[model samples]
Target chain A: MSSNPQLRRAVTPWGSFSWGYSDVGADIFIGLGLVLAYAAGASNFAFLFAGLVYVCIGLAYTELAAAYPVAGGGQYFVLRGLGDLFGFIAGWAVLLDFTIDITLFAWSSVDYMSQLLPAVLASVHPWSHFLVVLGLIGLLCLLNVIGVRESTAFQGSVAAVDVLSETLILCFGFLFAFQPQILIHTMHVSWPSMFGLMQGTSLAIVSFVGLESISQAAQETQRPASVIPRTSVVLILTILIYAVGYSNLALGMQMWHPVHDAHGHAIAFWQLFPGNGDNQGKAVALLSAQIPYYGLLAQFYVPILGAILLLISANSGVFGSSRIAYSMSTSKLLPSVFQRIHARFRTPAASILTFCGLAVVVLIFAALPQLDHGARAVYQRLFHGEDGITFLGDLYAFGAATSYSFVFVALVALRLFDPMTPRKFKIPFNIPMRVRGERVEFPIIAVIGFIGIFSILVFTLITHDIGRVAGPGWLILGVFLYFLYRRNKKLPLFRSQPHDWRTAQTSILKNAGELELMDEYHANLRASDERKRALR
Target chain B: MIRLRTGFYFLYVALGTIILVRVLSFGVRFETITGIVLGILLIALGIYRLFQVTRVRTSKR
Candidate 1:
């Protein structure tokens, strides 16, 4: 094997779409239930609010990923635009999300499987469920270390089936059980308090969390400049529709299962979904199982499908964490050990094992209350109630909100600073301006996106008892490690090292086999240089 | 590949139209506003995709 083995450009357009769909789409399976539990009747509004902001973030990603098609994603974009310190922070926050993703989806996967096998339900058999989650994480880590990858065809087929199934659920629910008056009445009567709304909106962003997958896979995508924009736009729309549709359907539909209150009286469907822990993680499966005629067949397959999708998502978490660490290592933000691939496996063994270990530690931390009576007492006293999945969800939302806020800022900064890179797609509604005699299209949407995500961050801090404490704690630990590593390596701690990004962009485009974009970049550089010389 | 791309674009267009018709059939209400907005966005996206596909085909020809 060659010493310098580059990632092959093998991911086609459908592959790119499936890569993103499998990650972002799986979030709703868990997120819908969480939002419904907290947001209640206003769940649709929560999804809409976050979905709009997500659209802005998605657009920013599309522009950046197309212009600078690399595997590093938001971290690379931030490093290019905002300097090293902010880049490390963004990457670290993303790393937090990736770790949470591993444990959270693994836990949810088991919960989905528990739909068929009641023995593994996390709510009832916490220890057993925790053990299963650990086993799954270990399995994923092993598979990743051995460099096992699912084919694009398989992934696409799954995504297609999921999309069709979800659409059918929505269609059938609307046709048979849905009533607009019921939806309006629920929204009016069961509307959550301000704090609940804030928390729900914050949680709603989880449904849109994995947009980074597309940008991460951009480097390996064929004609990423064109394909990324197309796939990303479609992905953004698809996720938005599902989130909004599912929330609306949940509120409007008639109850299919007998939900009982404390007095054994019948309760509403919305009340039952969020109230039950098992149903919350596998909400989509339950929702699908309630759709009249479709429900008959869907009841059998949806849980299995949800479990498969959730497992795939958890595996992505393992894949993503190692890849981001590898990127950070190559950029000198992380220790070189992270970048070192195993001789035989030809994968980043250290990074995979290390992050996977951190994920297990996170799982343990989340499951502490569930595992021990003493810990449960402490958690109940301090944090009100202890739900492992909610704890993980809090951290996931916190990480995504924090990283995405920085990404919005990075988008604006890049538009201002990196004017020479050809952007095939730009976020709509930009204001034309000149900065230091260079023309810049100030991204208005990015500012809006920043405000929206920052608000979610604030909401996460305010509402999530465990997340507010643990999320910042994780960042603090990362910063401390960063300081130590930087000092030991004799690198600047706060400041960025000088990087020739123009040449880097050229190299990236060349490696992606984007000769047209490469030529466009060179031409822009030459024109800018000529103008500079003329001015001199 | 082109046929697959075209099929996807057509599907999006059809999906968008279905969403719009379905939502609008319920009439305009505060509760359904999100559906309306999403439907419009989907239609716009579908149209944009179709336009892009056409432009690429024409350029290739």
Candidate 2:
């Protein structure tokens, strides 16, 4: 094999990505906005701090991803850079994050549509949200089956609109007032309430979920190296739009306070919009217009633009997720049959079906009346508990955190053990000696990600009444399945290797026709790019 | 699309759609079997996916 630097460069700047993944920053805002807008009962300093932490983590990931551009997905990189267990966790987290995000977006779309076409669409078809979300999923799946370009176009179009709206919010929100008295002096954070704030921040963090969207799109990028950094810059800009713009808006509104009636029963206005000087009234009016009643054209557009931003974010989710379905299906994790690309589209048909299908399921679940906050912390009100907060399924916070945390630890461990690995962009870890920062010690940053992720997992899972065994329980299941599947397949692959479609294909080819699908696929790819690049 | 009891698949997809809507309505769980059952369901779905793959390939090309 020729030791061409071009081959080496194939990892980062030399890398390629799908465009759908590249544009996820736009959608991430929507995820964050939905969580921030609908669920801001607390001022989560931990989350804000975590966002600060993720910026470093994001840089670390960018460096590593750029250095090793062809590393594929988050789980794929973690598996290589971290180790088996951590990789599994990363993959699981990425999958879980994507899944939760899809569900949430579908739910949001239902709410948005309800606001828009609330006539026959809402009444005659009470179950219309289910159909609408399902249809949307179907449409996206069809797009994927058609081609990567189409999907990326979808992501790009949505994101372009989002950028315009976010610009409006940032421009206007700053103009409305920094409100230092309200900003700094509204500092009434209780210990328990602080934890609640973290949860809201977690939602803010959700806006960043589609960071993977760009990574996934690496294959389709014109210049993967240039694309990744450019994407990172744009992402930072968007985060500012969300963090500074939205956080200040929430703060200015005195949204942290309780709403009172003539009867003095305190009500909270989460779903309700921002208020006037009442904060509640103005926010509401702002929500109604996406235009501020009190501020400039840009200021007026902040709330309206926020919603528009979220809608765009949701659209990105729709776009990126279908590709994941295609990737997963192509790998045979779902079924090779689903792996078939459309003749002209070069997209996976079955994968698209799986993507949309799962999304619709989650949407319907989200729309359940029990999930909506009616009266009753406990008793009578369906799906209600003694506390007004509906926990919504087995979604333990720790599970979400652990998946990514392991990846962090894995990155650190890999750097220590494998010092000479090649990379495109290494993070600037200030470690004296040891190649003098030539190699970015990503482990430090990933370690931070690890701690933050693990902390969320521990605090939420341990504190919440999820069950005696549920916290450790999901973990045990991941382990048991690992062994059970291993035993059944018995290929002697390394420990904790996730048996997704790509890995399975790699294994099949390595074994030289031992795996049936690999044999067929290899035959088909007689002159494929990978084949041409192989040990000639 | 090679039909495979389209109604059954429809029913299956619809079943998941309907049940997922009410999944949270289940009062707090008291056992490990819930997640375990989910695992089993996942396995079953995986298997069904494999079957669909085989059928789609055999008929398509």
Candidate 3:
């Protein structure tokens, strides 16, 4: 790692700290937090805990990211900090994270649109909405290929809109029209319902997923060490933001009950206004649910505007994953094809297009006639009552949880094993009954990361509507995929071998002491870079 | 490349703010004591990780 510490910078750090912050946004999971807060019937405590888990993990990653701050977030970290096998698992887990990150947003975006265009979208006739979603994806991809400036400019604008719209909504939400009675009545504490909190963790986890940008953005930032430290601070800020917004959203929905688990915490948001909530004025009903609990005119159109802003924010989530992938590709972990720079636009065209394309597929399925169609009926029944889009998102969340567990373990293990490695930045902690110089103890952050992720994963494993068969089944598929990738490529059987006492004492340290580790590693990498440039 | 960086930054944040504001505002009677405890726990954890830095790095694996 010392030999090639800056490899990530070449692929990731765009330039400096300014560039890192300016470029990065939260991930698809954040979007999931919004949708899931409602989906899980999240109350203030639920969102708070869920949000805390996210920010806490973000803090873990924040420190790890500063230490490693490579292209692959958890995957890259595990490989280096742990071993190759766990690294492989981390990589596979990220695939789950990336794929579902794209799919979930695409589906939810389509769902939002369905309310606006029911006949064309909800009727499932010609499936015109599907095509439109696909086309829109293609356009995003094209734009990604066309130029970075275009992509960033558009996402930034919509991001601003997201912040602004929500601010108005929250202000209205906590205002006079907010009747505390309804929320107080619904605040039921049950062990059974805490399962909802576990399920909701998936949503909360979703919001923090985008913090990968901290690693991805390290390349572009002016000061990797300084900026990385601040990213943790920003994560704390983000938690406050999510906790408040989601809690009030739940409170705002006191006027009505959701369609059971069908509506979840999202129903809380949908319940802002008092009315029949019939399917007919559903769009108006959905929008009306947003009638600000504040002033007279505030109730008129603020919710509608906020919804629009959220949908726009969803698009940026797609953009976030695409950009990260592009950076990865350029680093050579992903195919060079994904690394293709729009000759004119100076952006990774192929990666962006792929992201947009997949999103449209999800949108089409989520919106329009198909979900209600007979085949769709059977499919939904076979899976459960929910559409594939939603379940798939849950599956994504499950994969995300499992994968995150690996990260926490890796962090703790690394702290135990490599107790005193040099890193550009460090997180602070204090320990009880410890030596004077050492106020804090080892793996404290690691312990926090482990506890939070483990508790959530335990809850997720137990309580969710995830198919008992499907959840583990997905992991089976992942294992099979790993084996297949291995057998075919003859890559490695022990994806990661345990480093025993002798191995760690001798081989590992011997290798670590290699005189020209960085020089050799970078030289080899530069050769590959030349080859790529030649091909280009 | 540039768009993914700077443009998307504002774009994504602009989008996230809605979720952020909403989540934060949903009033809950939080156990303030609990929160303070958690915050302190985090600070302690932070300081601990920093301490590991000053330890003996040249020690054998």
Give me the TM-scores of chain B across the candidates.
0.88, 0.47, 0.39
Give TM per candidate: 0.94, 0.64, 0.66
> Which has the higher lDDT value, candidate number 1 or candidate number 2?
1
For residues A1-536, could you state the per-residue lDDT of candidate 3 as single tens digits? 01111222222222222222222222321333333333333434555665666666676677776655344666656665667666666655555455555555434445455555567655353356455545545554555445444444444555554444444444444442344444444443211255555555554555455555456554433344445765456445534454444444444343332343354544444333222211211222242344444334433443333333333334444545555555444333344465555554455556666766655554544443253567656655564444444455455556666667787777665555543333444545623333322222465665776677677666655655553445567567756765665566555656443444323323322332332333443454456457658767
Judge candidate 3 at residue A66 and give its lDDT.
Answer: 60
Best by TM-score: 1
lDDT of 2 by residue, A1-536 (tens): 11111111122321222233333333333333334442353332433554555565566556544433432356655666554555544554455455545555444444444444557343235456456655655655555455554444444554555444554443343344323234333333212255445444443444445556555555445455445765564364445334433443444333323457678875433334211111221232233233243343433444333333334444444444444444433332223454455554444445456656755664554444334434333334433231211232224243345555655655565455444433345555545334322333434566566667566555455434532234356556655654554466552335544544345434523332224434444553453434446735
Q: Write the per-residue lDDT of candidate 1 for residues A1-536, one digit (tens) a residue.
A: 22245555668898899888989999999999999999998999999999989998999899999998887789888988899889999999999998999999999999988988985564678889889999999998988887623545667888888987776777677667766677878888999999999989989998998878888788778899989998998899889978887888888888666568899997767886564667788898888887888899999999998988888788778777887887788788999888787776666778889989999999998889878989989888988774888889999999999899999999999999889999989888989999866788998999999998899899999998988999999899999999999999999999988888877999999988889989999998898888888889
lDDT of 3 at A328: 43
Q: All candidates: CA RMSD in angstroms?
A: 2.6, 17.6, 11.4
Off by over 4 Å in 1: A1-3, A148-153, A262-264, A343-345, B1-27, B41-61
Query: Considering DockQ, where higher is better, how would the candidates rank from best to worst?
Result: 1, 3, 2
Tell me the TM-score that candidate 2 gets on chain A alone: 0.70
In DockQ terms, which candidate is top?
A: 1
